[model samples]
Target: MLTTAPFTELAAQMTGRVVTASDSDWDAVRQAFNVTADLRPAAIALPRDVDDVVAAIAYARAHGLRVAPQATGHNAKPLGTLHDALLVDVRALQEVAVDPAARRVRVGGGVKWERVTPLLAEHGLAALHGSSPDVGVAGYSLGGGMGWLARKHGLQASSVTAIELVTADGRFARVDADHEPELFWALRGGNGNFGVVTAIEFAVYPVAQLYAGTLFFGLEQAGAVLCAWTALLPDLPDEMMTWIKLMRFPDIPDVPAEVRGQAFTIVFGAFLGDEEDGRALLATLHELGPAVDTFAMAPPGVLGDMAMDPNDPLPYLSATALLDELPDSGVEALVAAAGADSGSTLTMVELRHMGGALARRVPGAGARATLPGELGMFSLGVPLDEASAVTVQAELDVVSRAVAPHKVGDYPNFVEADTDARGFFDEDTWSRLRLVKALYDPSDVFRGNHPIPPADVRSL
Candidate 1:
């Protein structure tokens, strides 16, 4: 029923590369972020601009092909990689422009946070970016990006001023609350269901420097450190942000020999205030005597150096949950399941503190009708062993149950290999997202790795 003519014509209209089954590089191009998500889509369109994206959508609709959009090919990469679908790799659209006058930045959907971060830093500005700079801006914000700046700036979606999208019918449209109100809302916190976003204009902050870095502790001191951290967080200035990571680095050069190849308690921090004050505040942390305390007040780029997640292509899978409470029982369960000691093969388990700016939603800003409430716990489950992935999940589930009653929702970005995330979020959010899907992409022609539940479907 579909003809190659439309695709051929559409490909000619685009500036970037177009890959098909006949191409020699097709084998390597189809796989999404996770090396394991290798599926044979009908074709892959790497469009350079909004017009190209629009044409690709037109061709896909004519050919009865589904569409998917990807920026970084990470996260529910399915959020971008359509299965047996026409994959639109928008990386060529990558561009970052800062509007100092408006205190905003307009970035191509394909641009990663890394590309945007340093540019903003050059201008004494900062975007409420995610933890890792590798994630695509669109996919990251669509999942309510609860990243490092979250405590100070709230959801990244909340800051978006404008968005350009290529819709189901191949129409290019601009999105803002006053414009396509419903679709705008859905694209913010809702997973990619509305259309293929080409670029986004969002707010940034004047974050010139900060006292920030990580403090690594021996596994034996996890409990004492956790208590000390809890006491410190409430008292610390809002400028400071912190998270606890229980992970083992796999004996890599960048990793320390003592902490590498084993588990440890690492305190990740970002102190936005003066260095001396920040250092003084850390006195208690040092008194606890961590095995490796790498704490310091630093410049904008320092955040990247401290967390330093691997940029190399990695085959990974993860899961996440938001907790309303972290009871003593929950702590015990986490320690029991994930273990206080880090011999487990899990790469990292990150627990971010939410609230502060994360709690306040901008008035009439976006169609982000959904977000978890204030001051809850969050957890990430990363599996290192393919054979043991299931077992690792079982153990993580134990940690999850330790605080299940308090689980409000799952962080969309962390919904790794699992595609059944409909059960993780709230119903209102789902309904709102579906309404946006109807308004902007009624054909359901773009079902990718992360399929938005059809509006008519039953709830999980």
Candidate 2:
């Protein structure tokens, strides 16, 4: 049997808070942002800094327990169970440092894009951050973060220069290209199967302004707008990036009266060059005569909020896939599944165009660099009741099957609960990840969000 005496003693020595099931706040401590995950971990440790993380790992090891590190818990659905493990809450480890001369920034495990983006903006520098500012930097980078500047800078993981982590053996180590080279490679895009990262350092870019905004049109014009946008995509420079979203806002007090219960098609984009040329390039989209237009020149700090992602926690189901092409047939399939006429109570349906810098794989960088397809397809369902849940799920299945022919696997960061881990990587890449998992986490002490099993367990 596992001993509790040592755990009690370890908790007494920690500078951070350690809560057990008996604690009044245990329910809140073990909760994830998605709300679907009702995790009941043996203990939840909120580490304030790097030392606290080290101590938590050591204590878990002594008691023969696993450690699962979580920052914002954005992608917690894939984390199977934590009954025999300690959930390391690193939200208090918020540290951010920027070196403008070297064009690099260092962030703590718990740091969010919201905090770092503004800090880097002071020096006219920008880090590759995901669409939402609330997303944790470490978790996002580990999963191959896709950002607004991705077309020019590439995935967030590609810019990583170093990682400081507490390994399964309770040892603190620094991994980089020149140090622990193999481990560094796995840590980049391999997810968090190796250890509890304390801090990560990556290069940033010198950017001050960008022409970005969203244009909205009624669902009646979706077909025409979608076709025009797709046709115009090829003519745009590598500095331009865009996506199309089909949304049906709910009729509620929280939603604006103007768009409440309204179904519309919106085109979102950002251009990296000067406003004049950017405007000229996007003039055609303007001619399409969207019902609403909000394009403007904005500071780098505003990029995080551009996508308009909800900051609060809620119950939802999401799925993601890469699309090789979006022909007329594909657009029809998309509209038929989640569009206004589909009768699906989905909150959002998006098709993000991918290519440019996102198409070129960085050599010896990580397991994944470039997307396997030309676009990313994401759908999210919001079910208010059991019947609604069933209805949305059925519709999601129809959407998946309809676009199955164009799918070419999925992006790791976009992967969700039901997706198989192997689908995120190719056969060779998955095999290499297994070996790396064996090397760093032989006993499988760290059970991260999307785990890569050890080599020995693959055959079984």
Candidate 3:
């Protein structure tokens, strides 16, 4: 059993509160965004500033405990069994500074995309943010962030100009291309293994408006819709990003009335071009005759909620894969596995178009400069009970098998479960990442969601 008595000194050293297992709000403090993730950390430090972060790291190190730096805990499921760790919750470090003139923004680690998207929209600027607006900017960027602009602008990590963090040694450091380039490269894609990130600065684009929205069809038409969508990808340009989702809308008050309690095969997209060209490009999908078409010109801010990801915590199991071009047979197999008649209770099965800028590595790029795949597939199911969990796991497995043949790799950001982080990169990149970890965090004091141990420690 853990006690607050040991944290008295640590609490006195910081302005933020230190939550222990003995505290009344321990359950609330230790909870992750994924309700299923039962995080039982030795203690949780809600750091209000960078100084408190440094103090938390020092305290954890002195007490022989590993430190896990987290903001929103979106992917906290991977940090399994945190009994020997101190979770430095940085949600209190909410800061947002946007310089529209320079096309740059610096946000505190705790800042979520929702907090910045609308502000940037007002200035006719946009960042490479993912589907959900609630995801923390720090965690999303630290992991390889992919979103609507990904096909044209590339991953959010590559756009990062600077990252400020408190390293394992309790020192504050700001790493950029010209300063600590090695660590900068690793932190962008390698995650928070070496330190606790306090803030991140990245470039935004001047996107005043674009043609974007969803095309909804009956779930029964999934196979036909998917086949047409795949065929249309070859003719699409980088400026046009699209995804097809087989979704079952829950009968909840939070969901829009029209989509509530309905299942549909939805084709959602954002095109950085005029409505005429966007409509021309999507003519094939339109010919299929969607039940409801919402295509129209909209500001970048609308893209944040376009995907309609759940904003609340829920128990769910997910599976993901990076896939090559899918043949007609592959499409049929996918439909057979998760379509309307598959008896699958999964909430969503989505395949996002990936290529163009997303597959090209530019000069001065970070460790995760490019992803390898023509499409990225992600699926999830909410398991309300033990029986439902087993059913969900089985359906997820079937969906995995459907795409297993064309599976190329996995995106670290989409990989929620704990696994070998090395698999996310090539041998050389993995080796270099380990070396950086050895140099900066030789004792392995920090624990990332996907932990990458030091080179020397790995050999042992």
lDDT of each: 0.70, 0.83, 0.93
Error of 2 at 64 (Å): 2.5
- Model 2 lDDT vs. the true structure? 0.83
Candidate 1 lDDT, 156-217, residue by residue in tens: 88888888887787788897878977777777766666678888989888876687777878
Candidate 1 lDDT = 0.70
**Poorly placed runs, candidate 1 (over 4 Å):** 1-9, 76-83, 252-259, 279-283, 340-343, 373-386, 417-426, 448-450, 453-460
Candidate 2 C-alpha lDDT tens digits along 117-229: 99887887788897888899999999898888888888889999999998888789999988888889888888778998889999999886688889999976777777887
Worst 10 residues of 2 by lDDT: 1-10
Clashes of each: 7, 0, 0
* Cα shift from native, residue 220, model 3 (Å): 0.3
What is the clash count of model 1? Answer: 7
Best-to-worst lDDT order: 3, 2, 1
Q: Best candidate per lDDT, number?
A: 3
RMSD of each: 3.3, 2.1, 1.6
- The CA lDDT at 445 in model 3 is 91
Best by TM-score: 3
